[model samples]
Target: MANYHRNNVENVVLGRHHHHSHRSKSASVAGHTFRLWNAASFRRIIFDAVSCGASSRYAARSNISDEKQHLQQKQQHHKTTSMKNNAKSEKLSDLLSIAEAETDVETKKKEEKLEDLKRLVKELQQHEEDSTKNKKSEAAAKVRLLAKEELEVRGTLAMLGAIPPLVAMLDETEQNDVNSLVSSLYALLNLGIGNDANKAAIVKVGSVEKMLKLIESPDGLDSSVSEAIVANFLGLSALDSNKPIIGSSASIYFLVRTLQSLDDESSPQAKQDALRALYNLSIFPGNVAFILETDLVVFLVNSIGDMEVTERTLATLSNIVSTREGRKAISAVPDSIPILVDVLNWTDSPECQEKASYILMVMAHKSYGDKQAMIEAGIASSLLELSLLGSTLAQKRASRILEILRVDKGKQVSGSYGLGAAVSAPICGSLSGKPDGGGGRECFEEDEEMMSEEKKAVKQLVQQSLQNNMRKIVKRANLPHDIVPSDHFKSLTLSSTSKSLPF
Candidate 1:
């Protein structure tokens, strides 16, 4: 029993010692593990703190750099704006300076002109007061200067009493005063141009009568002096108020004489001026009686072929044809209608065509004989061609004439037959089989042959007209007459038909 109890106690003591030792070992191992884990966490925290510090430094540096760059941009922008402003300022200054300089120049020119005019007036007055040759020559020089000046300067001089002296100078009869006369005459002419008040003032001052006196003077004037007088007439006649005043005072005769003198050694310019003056005078219908008193209508009709003065001549005739007497005068000419129709083929001068057509239209509308004359002159084909390929105005006129002819045709047919014949008329030829004298068949055959012949004749007329017109057009274009192929011309002729003709 004692041994067993002793064994139990030993066993219990051994178990207690073993359990305590295990407990102590486990506690030591746990403490070492905790220390290792704490060390790892601390290292991680240190690394993260270093990373945050570096990020803050980088952010600060970036902000500073951005601020500096922004400052540079602001400075550059301000500099660029200042430069643009300065450039604009310089440009504006230059423009302003240039404008001021121009204004000053204009003012200076005006002052100079005023001074020159005053000097001219003084010189003219001196010449008027003193009849010495030197004074006259100086006065003549001033008049010549006045001729070259514009309307404004001439107006100023006239207001300063410069024209009466010039007029007085016109009465000089001495041969030595010829130059002074020419100077005064031309100065007066220049003063009248483009200034109606000056024109009226001049005519009021007896310029026309003075010129007529010079023209009719016993000692016949030289050609140059005559031209100067005609030029004066032209300048005066431009005014409608002066047309009658000048046209009634033997000016028309002088103008016609001047135009006639063109065939001689007279200046062509004088003829042109006379034509223009006559045209102006002719525009007044009452003046047509005076113009018809002269052979101007014949002269104008004959001169229509003159290419140099064709437009003016036609323009004058256009005015002449407006009056009843004028129309009779034109139609009285043997070939006036023919000549006007020929002008329709003048493709080279559309102006000539328009004026000629206008004259014809006026005549044809007023006089039935004129329409027949135009039709007999072969105006239909020419009108057709014109309508197809003419200027806008020419085309309109051509179409109008065609309409007139078309409308007049019915009137002509109706007039030839009695207007009161309402019943149907039988055919003139016998329809019965009974044979009578050969007159009926022969007349019917003759009528048919006449129609066929007329158709062929009209075709030939159109072809001939086309050829002549084409040749004229070629000549005017400065090309060879045969530049257009004959075959093409034939095709054109073939395409044209008298059946379609309104006339």
Candidate 2:
């Protein structure tokens, strides 16, 4: 029984050992599982941290890049703006510099002009103090200088009392003094260019008489002296107050003479100057009589077609034709009406055409003989053409002239046919041209055959009369007999009459 109890105890101990060993193995497994779980959680946490850090760093880098780009854009904009400002500043500086340079040049020119004027004044004063030959030469030089001066400078010299001395120098009387006189005359003329006061002063100082004396000297006048005189007259007579003074003197004679003497050597400018002076003088009605005394109407009429002087010459005639004496003078010229009528054909020169029309209108209105002359000059064709193709004013004048001719004819016809009872032709036939006067017996003849014979005789007579009238018109127009085509003329039945003509 003791052995059995010990075995039992051993078995119990083995069982307890087995139980303890199993419990230790279970503990070891649980501890190992816990450690593995902790390690897995740590690895996951570390991975999440690394991901967050990487994302934050990338965001920082992007922000830095954006700031840098913005900075670059600002710098570029600032650089462009600075360049534009610099360009504008440079341009402004250049413009300012140019303006300053131009201003300096103008200032220098003004100072130089002032100094030149002072020198001229000093020279003029010295010239006034002496009359020696050297002084006379200096006087000539001074006058020559004054001639080239502007109107203001000439006026200034004139106001300094230069004119009377210049006129006094005209009496130098030496044969060599002609040049000085001519110079003085031109200087005087230049002074009177735009200064009326100087013009009056020059005339008041006997410059005109002095110039005339030089011109009318026993020695024949030089062409140069005559030219100077012409320029003086042109300048002096521009003033209305001086017109009669110049015209009443021998100046009109000289002007007309100058115009008449247009030689190869004569400058066209001189001729124009003479015409302009005459035109100025002709403005005064009193001067026209003096102009007529020079017998200029014929010359003016002959010169009407010269294009260079046509306008002024016609203007003079226009002024002249305002008076009865002028109209008679113009009408006395053989070719005046014809020449004036021809001007209407100058389509290119409307001014000349207008002036010529004016002269014709005046002459026609004043004189009946002028009307016949215009008709004789074949003005009818020209008038018809002008009425159709001329300027507005020309058409009006042409129409007016045609009306005058037509109205005058109507008056003459009415006066001749009114109650005077010179003769009346029957409707069928007339006895006016017959040698035997047909009494009331012929009026009663009503046979158709006899009436037809009478009609044929009357038609022959009418055709003869028409030919005679046409010949007269053609002869008066100075046209060729065949001017109208023969067939065209034959086409005109007796139905057409002189009354149907443009004239």
Candidate 3:
């Protein structure tokens, strides 16, 4: 037991010695590192001292070992390299940090801009709904400005569910209230200017009738408002489905009255707008007879010299004279045939040329073929050009008319058959009794007698005034009034009720 106790004491002594030795070794390495750094400074001092005595061999004989000096220089170089590497890493870290910070700032700025756009759109929509008049007007002006940038916004309001409410907003305003009314029109115009779906949506909400009613309001409503309504109507009616709806008899009649109310001599813009609306409405063939009942046919035909009005005028007439009664009514206007032929030279539009050519073709088939007035108005040459280069339909009509006009009169007298000759037969039979040697006026007077009392007075007055105008227009064209304007000048025929023309 005593030997074992002695053995444990000896082991403990040995362990302590081992730990002390290891601690001493670590301390020695640290001391050596510090001393090496100091030795570099001392070597410089000692070299200076030796240089003062000029003793190179004495400096080499100093106490420091060569291996220890080499070790000290190695350690110093390693420490300097490590510090330079750390400094370079710190600079790179700073640059990376700056770049990351700049990227974060740009991302936040973009997010803020997007948020501002959303807020602006939402605010404008809210302003549109405000109860206060000023707020509503402000919203309207704002939204109008926004919609003006439709390419930028692309119906952003549509994304925010603002279109239908805007359509309904038109219902809340009075046509007489200029601010409220104009605002609604502006919004609707912008809204309708969106994609086809947006326009179809506007139409789906029954805007055609609303716009027409605003248009039909008396001249007392602000002209700007009326003009806006007409402009909006034009855009909406551009859709084919909207055309039939707005082209109803009542609306066409209203449009014609609107035209009559505008003085072509003074209010040219008003006349242009109203006439264009009527022109668009005339696309529906079913509405032609209703338009005929109004004095609009004579009105439009008379106004054809206005370049602003001529294209639409000829276009509407092209649709009108497509009907049998329409051709006869249009034939009654002294300026109609001549004006249609003149459109070919003055207008650059091929459609205008085609329409005018087609009208001449129809008139030739009905009455104008045999008339020296149509031939004098330069119908022959226009028909020739269109016969060759016009649309296929216009080409066919022009070819037939040329045959009628170019063919021998002896064949016509003998009832020789052609499309124009066939069409002229029915109208010629009706015109044979007129004062123009057509023998048709006595029949017109008889038909006039059969009309209602109110109709008789209006018809006589309109007839007398128109006859005077016809005489002047015919004289200006240097043609006999009796030849160009057919004798049953101011009357509607009750017998010809067919929608399609006799042709």
Top-scoring candidate (lDDT) = 1
Candidate 2 runs further than 4 Å off: 1-41, 127-175, 187-210, 216-220, 236-250, 261-269, 284-286, 302-312, 333-354, 372-382, 385-395, 408-503
TM-score of each: 0.64, 0.63, 0.52
- Clashing pairs for model 2 are none
Q: Compared to the true structure, candidate 3 yields what TM-score? A: 0.52
Q: Which scores greater on TM-score, model 2 or model 3?
A: 2
On lDDT, the stronger of 2 and 3 is: 2
| Candidate 2, 1-503: lDDT as tens digits | 34444655665566556656665433345344111225775576567566666777898999999999999999999999999999999999999999999999999997886666555545544534345555555655665675576666776677566777666666654545567667777777777888999888888878778778876888777777778889999999999888888888898988887888857545678888999999999999999999988789899999877888888889999999999999999998888888999998888898888889889988888887887778667675676667666888888888788767545632421111112212222344445655455733465464344445544443443355456556656876899877663666665735554344333
Candidate 1: residue 448 lDDT (0-100): 72
- Residue by residue across 255-346, what tens digits does model 3's lDDT show? 56656774533255655666777777677787677788898889878877776666688888988888888888887887766777776554
Q: Which candidate gets the maximum TM-score versus the true structure? A: 1
State the lDDT at 323 in candidate 1.
88
Instruction: Tell me the deviation in Å of residue 86 in model 2.
Output: 2.7
Residue-level lDDT for 238 in candidate 3: 67
| CA lDDT, candidate 1, residue 372 | 69
Clashes of each: 0, 0, 10
Backbone clash tally (model 2): 0
Q: In terms of TM-score, which candidate is stronger, 1 or 3?
A: 1
